[model samples]
Structure formats: C-alpha cells, structure tokens
Target chain A: MIAAPRKLPAPWVLRTFVVLILLLVWEIAGRHGSQLLFSPLSKVLTSGLQIFAEAEVLEALKTTAWILVVGFVLSVAIGLVLGLTVSMSRFTYQTFLPVLLLLYAIPQITVLPLFVLYFGSGPASKVAFGVSHGMFPIAVSVIAGVQGIKPLLVTSAISMGASRWQIFRRITLPYLTPSLFTGMRLASTATLLGVLLAELYVSAGGIGHLTRRFGENFQPDKLYALIAALSLMAILINETMRMLERRYSRWL
Target chain B: MSGASSAGQALTLRLSKSQKRLSLLVKIGVLVALLAIWHLVTVDEFVSPFFLPKPDEVLRVFFNIIVTGQAWPDLKVTLFEFALAGPIAVIAGGAVGFLISLTRYGTRAFEPIVSSVYAIPIIIFYPVSVMALGIGPESKIAHGALFGFFPMCLSTIQGFSRVDPLYIRLAHSTGASKSQLFWRIMLPAAAPTILTGVRLGLMLSFLAIIGGETIASLEGIGHRIVWYAEGMQTGNMFAYIVFVIMVAVLMNTALSFLEIRRGRQ
Candidate 1:
C-alpha cells in the first residue's frame, strides 16, 4: 500500500471544515424538518445566554457544580487514604486489591436510587453518588503507583536510613503525584457522570428538571443550550486537569 | 547492615500461612461488620424502615421476583437493546477506527476530537434521544450504540497506531504484502488492546441502555426499578437493583476472563 505522499489540509482546518459541514447540514435539516425534532446551532447559541438569566437554571447549575466539586475533593481524599493504607504491606495489597477491584467494577448507577433513598432526593444523594463513582480511579491509580516502584529502590532507600515516614514522603509522594493528577482527570469525568445521572433520573429539580421540562415542552433550542453549557463545563474541568497533569509531569 | 535491612524488607513481604489466614480473617471480618451495621441500623430504627428495608426483606423480594418470573420481561427488554447496540457499535467503531489509524496525520486530526468528546457525558443527549425516538427501545439502542462507539474507536486506533515500528520495518524488508502485514503481524499484536476496547464497549452499551431506560423509557430493568421506587416498593426496587448489579458483575468478570485468556494466546 506504499504510495507517493499527497497533500493534506492542516489538521485544524480539516477539523473546522468538518464541524462547519455538520453545522450546515444541521441548519438545513432544522429549516426543512419537523420543529419538534431539531434546533439549529444558531437558535441554540442565541437562546443559550438567556438560560443564564433564569433563576431556576442558574440554581441548578450551581447545585450541580457544588456537588461535583465537593464529591471530587472527598473522593481524592478517600482514594489517597485507602490506596496508601492498602499499599502498606504486600499481604494487605494481595488480600484487599481484588476486593477493591470488585467494588469498582460494580456500576454505581444501580445504586442511584439507594443513594437517594438513604440521603434523600437532594444534593446529598447526588454528592454521595459522585463520590462513589469518582473515588475508585484515584484509589486504583495510587495503588498502581505505589506497587510500581522498584523493590531495589526501596531497599536502597532503606539502606540509606530513610525512615518510614521519610521514605514515603521522599519516594512515594513524588512518584504518586503524576498518577494522582491523571486519576483526578479521570475522576472528574466519573464524578460528572454520577452527578448528572442522578440529577437526570430524578428530574425533580436542578438542570435535569429544567431539561426534562424543556423536552416535554419541545423547546429544542433551550435543551440544546443547556446541553452545550454542561458540555462546556465538562471540557473546562477536564482541560484544566489535563494542564495540571502536564505541568506536574513535565520533568518526567 | 544493608543486607540485614534488605532481609527485613523481604521478611515483611513474605506471605506466610498465618498472614494468609489473617488476610482471610480481615476480608470476612469486613463483610460481617458491614452486614451487621446494616442489620442493626434497620432493626434498631436508627434509620426509618421506609428508607432502609432490612436485609431479609430485600432478599425475600429478590427471591419472590425470581420465583414468579416478574423480572423476565424487563430483563428481556434490556438484553434486546444490548444485543442490538453492542455489535453495531463494535463493528462500526472498529471499522472507523481502523481507517483513522491508517495514517499518522489522520490520527492526529481526529483523535483529539474523539477523546475530547468522550470526556463529555453525552448523556445530555438523552432528552433529545427520547424526543426523537419516542421513549422506545429504538432510542436506547441508538444512544447505547453511540455511547459505546467512542471507546471502541479510541482503543482500535491506539491498538493499530501503537504497534511496534521495528516489527513493521522487519515485515516490510521481508516483502510482506499490505494485507499480510496487517493480518499476520498487526492483528495479533493489536488483539489484546482491541479486545479490551470491545469489552469496554460492550459494558458501556449495557450501561448506556440501562441509563436511558432509567431516564425516560416505559419498560426495561431500569424502568422497573424506577417504577418500584416511585410506587414506594422499596424492597422490590432493592431486589431489581441487586439483580442488575449481579448481571453487570457477571458479564464484566466473564469479559475480563475472556480477555486474560485470549491475551495468553
């Protein structure tokens, strides 16, 4: 399949072209198609700013953001603690790692109602659910980080008279930083999933409620606008995490 | 002194019989403690019984549903969506991914877009999906497939593009045909990574379908759980949740085992 190389458009140009074509198609379809089914990008963009003025939508966004932040912070804390604890000894690691993995594999969605039941159909349930979804990646990442260090390095560190605390601080902490950040990136994604899923499933209040209302009323413009806002939030969070990860790991 | 310290480190890690037993004890101890807490909390009414049904009540509900086959129709619906979605996602994703991987420039062009889109929940599309597909199995399948496709596509691209360059050079020097290089060298090399993607894609398909059903569907396992919850049949709801969790775990375990086994080959 070897052939002479041919000219290709710049990546960004191609990407922009692809996006533009899709938007053009969508606009055409929206014009000619059922109003019940589609909204053009222009309509969504115009209506998007107005959504921010609504107290209910603003409140939902605040609630969702708060839940995600609190849940993410707590998850990182718990994940680090559990990961460090389990990695303390080989026996502990061997014994408990599988158990932790099994728990991680169990889709947290199944227990969304259970969370709502236990914590009430409020922010607490959503936060708890987000924590559950978010914690595992960090925990697993930390575990891998700990276990990945060479035994020879540990032996040498001990030989040099590194105290348990000092060894952990000097050796493990530095090693874990990169993974911890990457795990945070992954955890952010999961946290968003858990919070959004709970919010959507219930539809009593918050972004989910507003979107459900919009859907029922066939307000496609508002629905698209809401989705776009949420997606922008997601992208910002992830991109920030990525930048943090890169900045930290630049030396490596 | 260094030797002695090294010896001590080795000793600390040694999994002696008593350590294994202690590990087992800790594992069982944790489970017993959790169950005891659940039992005590409900029995002592530390929490309202309305919210926290006793374990036996949950079990009874689970058993009764199974014996009466009440779960069958819901299970069937979920499974049908999964069946329709999973294969469609895999084949389509794999094909698209392979094409993207054909050139490094192509990968650079599209990979970022795929990954960035992947980070977004995309579940926001549910309301639109429900609207368009009318709250039927069609919406679930379509959304589930869409959800599953990205993971498969990402992994497939990773699998092909990340193949060792040295091997490709060797194959080329030996005058291997394009197809021969792909099938004989590339496929096997990429099989493990691709399998992982397929497994994840399959898992995601099931999860997406369940989530869709939970949100807006009239019937399915997820719908039934919501139905029970809304009706205040907490025990029945717990049963369905347990049933779904078991199904998910079993499939996940089986898929992992399949991956590990294939990896050996």
Candidate 2:
C-alpha cells in the first residue's frame, strides 16, 4: 500500500532556533559556573585570541598543518598506485587482498611506540605514523572502486575497438573519481587523527608538548583555548573536503 | 571446428590457472623476502636493536610475557574500562536520541548539531577530560563515552525517525495505548538501526579508550606498550601490540555478530 506523504518540519528554522538557545544557555552557564571547568564564553574568546599571539602556538599550528598535508598526499599517492597494481589482475587481487586486510585490521596504534622507537621523537615518526594509518582506507576504497567496474563495460569497450589506453583513460578514470574523493575524505580524517595522536604521544616539540605544559601548569584557560583553536582547524579542513566531495560527486 | 575451439579454451583456462599459481608463489616469496631482509639488517647491526629489534628477539620476549603472565593486569584494566564505557555510551546516547526524535522538529533541530560536532575528532578533548577527571580509568571512560556517543546518537535518531508513521497511526486507531504503541511499534522498528549504532559505538569506544591510555594513565594495553617502550623492552612491546590487536579483532567480531542477531530478531 502506498503510504500518505507526511510533511517534514521546517528544518532550517528549527535548527537555527535550537542553536541560538544552546548558545544563550552556554553563555549563562559559563558566566555563573565554577571557574575551574567553565570559563565564560567571553573569557574563552579573549584567551583564544591571546593563544594566537604566542609564537609557539602559531608554530605548532604550522607544523601540524604541514604534517597533515604531507601525510595525506603521500597516503593518497601510494594508495592509488598500490590499488591500481593490485586490481590490474584477478590473480594479484586474490593473493594479496587478504594480506592487506589483515594488516589493516591490526590496530596500528599498537605499533605506534615502535614508530617512535625507529624514527625517534621527531616529525618523521609522526608523519610515518600518519601515513601508516591513512594509507589503509585509501587502499581499501580504491580497490573496491576499481573492482566495482562492471566486466560488461570493459567488454563493450573492447568490442567497440577501444584501445587499452583509451579504455583506462576514458572509462576507468571517470568511474573511479567518486570513490577516489571518498577515499581522500577518509584518508584526510585518518591522517589528522594519526598525526595528532603521534604528536600528542611524542610530546617533544609540537602541540602535544604545549598541551602537557598547560595541563601541568593548571593553565586551563590557555589549554582550553588551544584545543578549541585546533578543533576549529580540524573542523574547517573536514568541511572543506566535504564540500569538495559534494561538488565532485554532483558533476559525476 | 568445435573440437579445436574447445581445446583452445581449455589451454587458455590452464594458462590462467598456472598464472594464478605463479602469482601466489610470488606473494609468499615477497613476504619471506621481507622477513629475511629484516633479520639480516638487524643482525648486521646496521639498524640498532633498540630501533628495530630482530624478529627472534621479539618472539622470545613475546613468549616470556605470555609464560610469566605479566600482561594480564593491563589487559584486565583496558577491558574493564571498555566494559564500563560501552554500556554507558549506548544508554546515554540512545536515551538522548530517543527524546530528540519524539518530535519532528526536535530531530531536525539536534541531528545537525550532533553530526557537525562529531565531525571534529573528539580526542582533542582528551586533555580536558584528564584535567577534570584526573589521570586514571575515569578519564578514559569519559573520553570513550564522548567518542562513542555521537555515532550512537546519530544512528538512534535515524532509526526512530525512520519508523513508519502508518504503524503509529494503526496502533492509535486500534485503541492501543501510548506505551503499547511505543513498545510494539517504535522500539521494534528502530531496533536494527539502534543496534547498528551500538556496534559502531563499541568500536569507537575501544579505540578512544586505548588512545586515552596511550596519551595518559598508568594502565591499560596502550599504556603497557608505552611502558615497555620507555623501559627499552622492545620484545614485550611487540607482544603487547599483538595482544591489543587480537582483542580489537575479537571485540569487533563479537559486536558484529550481535548486530546480525538483533537484526534477524
């Protein structure tokens, strides 16, 4: 039986109203609550600005950004190449896919200490850790994307006298773009998580060290502000990639 | 003509089968080659033992840890924290999500906020959690719950919101009470999605707890790795890493099985 259509509520207006109310409540609660856990919104705002004033915090931001970019690029490039090679032949896919998945399933975090041990407590360890974490998702997604191509499509192209290069360039590349974008999105998040976690763990030089310092000093305001800033950066990067995914998917 | 064509096809099939066998051999050869290289490099002292311990040493250490039962306490603590955090996250996330889904407007109002906040890796708040809860299992629990909460809540909302309205209307027309309607219609319909959320939450909860242990604290699997690493006990660290990965895999498998069972019901 066909169900009668129900009216969906006005989502935008309702969401806006809820957000405003939450902000108002937060402002009031922050203003009145104990100073330890709840810094007023205004105080946090000012402290956030002051955090940017510190050269070290700015440097940490720069370092984190650089690692994220490098790690993400490496993961995508390596993943794409490996994925293509493995998917090129059914024999390779059968022989290697299980092994790849086993490695992927292992909590890479378990070997994070090994990474630090081998690479030392430097950006190298962090980048290596990030790459290890980020590469798996991209590889898995790319394999899925490549393997998902219908055999009929390839057969049809071959029957029409399309050259190997022509088939790959025109048919395979376009079909894989959406999956590639999805892989990038996952890789970006994984890379950020890996880099940030490694940075925090190493605690020699970076935001992790700064976080430890603030925690030890009981500089809750500074710590809160710093975390907030980093969270915003993460959110911004995530949103930008999400937007790109949407835009690309629409064209596809 | 038919015999010749069949013979050609058979030859092609045999050629493909041999190619497959060759590829399998190559794959195994590659793995063995890698291990050989690792052994050689470490034995030659080109790479420091501290940096990359020989495979034999790692295996010996693993055997020692297993024999001595040195890893039990850390394993227990990590499991204990996970046991506590997983249920709390499911209940809290589910209750809150259910409340929010009661009204059409509420679902629209809260889901976006929940999802956007979730998009940010909540691990950044780990320090804050430590500050508030101190460096112990409590902070880990808090972090785990927070990490697990978003996915659970989002899926719960999706689950309940997608419950067919026709069922609700039929229940009401049949003079079913509010309690009966909710229990018979809403909860049952939403159970699969809710279970899916719980499964996702369980996985994230373990990851966050391990992360929290690694970043801080004196206990748990993650802490054990760091503890051994700092002590320059490379072999024990490798053993603990294996143990942790095994536990993660087991937990994931169990949860997915539970999800499938619930979906069937």
Candidate 3:
C-alpha cells in the first residue's frame, strides 16, 4: 500500500498566520507612514483605554445600542403583524406585495434626511430608521414562511375541524419559528446598517460624532481604536443572531 | 374539505378577472388613504407640520423641478460617481475573487478573512476615504468602489469555486483545453451566481455613493437633499427625496427587466 500523504494543517491555523503577516506589515509600514495614513497595531492596542475611558464615548455607545434594541423589538412586532395581515388573503397579498416591493426597492438611505428632519438628530430617528430597515426583511421572511406550507397540510388541518387560531398555533407558528429566527439575523444586520448610517449622517451626536471628532483630530491611534470598538459590536451582534438562527434551524 | 377547497379554488379562478381589478382599486385606495391621513394629521396639527410638509406642496415642488429641468445637474454628479465606481468594483472585485478561488488552498486561506472584513461595515472607513481622497466626488467614487467590492468578490469566489467537480473532470476526460473548459463549462455554470454578485455590487455602489455624499460632499443628489434640509427648504427636500426614490425604482425595474431578458438568452 502507498504511504498516505501528509495532511495539511487546519485552515484556521493558516488563516491566523496570514493575519499575523498582514499585521506585521501594517505595523512596519505604519512606523514609517504619514500621520494621515495609519497607526501601528501596537499603538491601537495600547490606546484602547483612551477610547473606552471617555464618558462621551460610553454615552454614544449606549445610544447606539439602545436604538438598535428598540428598533429590533419594533421590527419583530411590526413585521409579524404586517406580514400576517398582508398574507391573510390572496387578494391582500396581490394588492400589497407589489407596493411593498416598490417601497423596498428604493434605496432607503435617500430618506435619511427626512427621518432626521422628522425625528431630529435624536435616538428616535435612529430607532425609526433601523426599524424601517429591519422590518422589511422580517416581513418578507414571514410571508415566505407562511407561503411555504404545503396546501395538503392546510387542507388536512381544516378537514380535522381546526379553527383559525388552532391552525396558526399548531401548524403555522412552528413552521415560522425557523424562518423568523433567520429573519432576525438578517434584520439585525439591516438594523445595524440603518442606525449606524443615520448616526454617521447626523454627526451631531452619538457614535458618529466621536468618529468625526477622532478623524478631525487626526489621532489615528484613537480613530483606529474607536472603529475597532464599532467593529467588535458589529461582530458580536451578527454572531449572536447567527447562533440563535442556527439553534432554531436544527429542526428544519 | 378538500373538495370544498377545490370548489373554492374554482370560484377564485372564475372571479380572477374581477379580483384583479378589485386588487388595483384596493391598492389605489391604500395609497389615497395614506395620503389623506398625512394631509389630515398635518392639517389637524396632531403632530408638528414641521415633521411632514403638506403632500400637495411636496408634489408641487416635485413637478416644478421636473418642468423647470432643475434636477439634471445633481443627477449628473451622482451618476458619474456610479459610472466610475461600478467598473472598478466589478473588474477588481471579479479579478481578486477569481484569483483567490483559483486554488482550494487560496480559497481556504482567504475566503473567511474576506467575509469577516465585509461583515464589519467597513463603511466605517468613510473617514479614511475622506482623508485619502478628500471631500469630493472622488471620495464618493472610492467609497462606493470599496464598499461594493466585498459583495462582488465574495459571490464571485463562491460562484467560481463551487462549480461541480464532475463537470470539470468530464471536460478534462474529453481532452478539453483549460480555456475550452472554462469557457464552455465554468462560465455558463457560474454566470447566474456571478451576475447576482454584479447586481448586488451595482446596488451597493449606488448606496455607498449616496451615503458618502450624505456624510460630506459639495455636490450630488444626496448633497442636494442635505443642502435643502440644512437651508430648511423642507418642501424641496421632500421633492428631491421623492425624485431620488423614483430614480431608484426605475433603475431597479430596468435592471430586473434586463436580467430577465438576459436570463432567457
């Protein structure tokens, strides 16, 4: 028998090494680089407390988080209600989905000014925008989940004299759970985009205010630190949602 | 119950024509009701009218610009950003993705890294773009290209690398040249997925340009809205919002139409 070829090391090991090389290069380059360009990774690590210790930074972080939670909760509520209502009858679906599609098609960023104009540069506007972004995906996902039930199952349930509420609770709810979780994951992403985009646009307050301040101050180390915080938040949100989605989807 | 449902279905089929008309009427009714509510709420001052200008006033501003041909210059700047960003995103993203996907080893080495970076809303680097390119159309173009590149690259890598091994092996067995195999087998198989990436990239570019302009710009459609908003020209700002929405809608419809027509071929 031929001797087995040596297997390569795991992919993650390779990935880590690649990252280390890039970071080394970045640090080396930054040592000689212009002030506007970059900060060494060493500097970024050491400056973490400088970014975290600022009270205003903490407040902005809280504001962003609070808005995201409010928007996400509202999205779940509205998406379920609206999605169910629109899918109530074939007529309603035909009447509303095309219009919904039209609304969804438009780049929502176009309306940022209107949202800011209406809600002021407050968390209210940020929450509203996040809900707007988050709700559509949830609604779309719910509609898809509701539509996915095979006709025979519905027919069988009706034949067994199931009432509307029974039909929903026993049949529809379980079927929708996986998709709902999936929608939450997507909604989380969209909501983050919307809230962050609004914050960035406002630039008068919140996390965006800090970013603009850092950039203008030409403090690349602090700028990088603050951005790294935002990136960490984004990854945490996404990973949490992904985990929940995965857990619920095992039955599916 | 199944038979009754069949009868219900037959009934719907018979009523399809009238239902279609009824659906249109319902849709129109919904729009009318929404507008009426907007008008009444503002008229009643239930909420501050500052939050929502009158619908008629917004419409008037919308038409005045169209009739007077005032929206063209702003549209030109935004579209120019689009035209510049779109090619860079497509060509560079596609090439980078293809190169990374050329070997399984490369794919394993890079795909996760690229995807994680994409997930971070690297748009946070808008300041970096602004710093590098300054507050102008060039910045928007660069911002758009950078933001748009991720989706295109990710999808292209997915598309090319995931083609069936069976197809590749069959082509090889048939004495197919590398170019022949790529052209005849890989291209067709990957076309739909790659096109999906391209479409996403296109949309992202549009959004990024608008976003970059929104954050900071001297001119562009997004800037036009900010200009009016800052100046307290609410009516005109509302009109520009509607105009931009219409443009978005039209572009998407045109894109879908093109996609369908091309898909058939």
Best model number under DockQ: 1
Error of 1 at A102 (Å): 2.0
Ranking by TM-score: 1, 3, 2
Q: Ten consecutive residues with minimal summed lDDT in candidate 2 chain B?
A: B1-10
Which parts of model 2 are misplaced by more than 4 Å?
A1-9, B1-33, B43-46, B162-190
lDDT of 1 at A141: 79
Strongest candidate by TM-score: 1
Cα deviation at A108, candidate 2, in Å, is 2.1
lDDT, candidate 3, at B184? 90
Model 2 lDDT per residue over A26-134, tens place: 6788778767766666777787569888898889878888888899999999888877777676677767776787788787777888889889888999989899988
Candidate 3 per-residue lDDT over residues A1-252, each given as its tens digit: 011235866768888998899989978987788866678888888974477888888888888888889999999999988778877777777788778766778788889998988788878998999999999988877777776656688889999999999999988898888778888888888888888788888876777667766776687888788888788788778888878988987986
Every candidate's DockQ is 0.48, 0.45, 0.45
Clashing pairs in 1: none
B1-265: candidate 3 lDDT, tens digit per residue: 0222433443443338889899999899989999999999877778775667888889999999899879999999999999999889988999999888877777877898887767677668887777667798998999899988998999888988888888988998899998898889888877777887888887888888988888889999999998999988888888999998888778766766765566455
Candidate 2: what lDDT? Answer: 0.81
> What lDDT does candidate 3 reach at residue A223?
79
How do the residues B1-265 of candidate 2 rate in per-residue lDDT, one tens digit apiece?
1223422333343336678788779878888998999899999889887777888887787777779878889889988999999888998999899888887777776887787777676877888888778898999999999989988998899999998888888987899988898888889999998998999998999989998999888998899889989999776777778778878999888998999898878
Candidate 3 chain B, which ten residues in sequence have the lowest lDDT sum?
A: B1-10
TM-score of each: 0.93, 0.88, 0.92
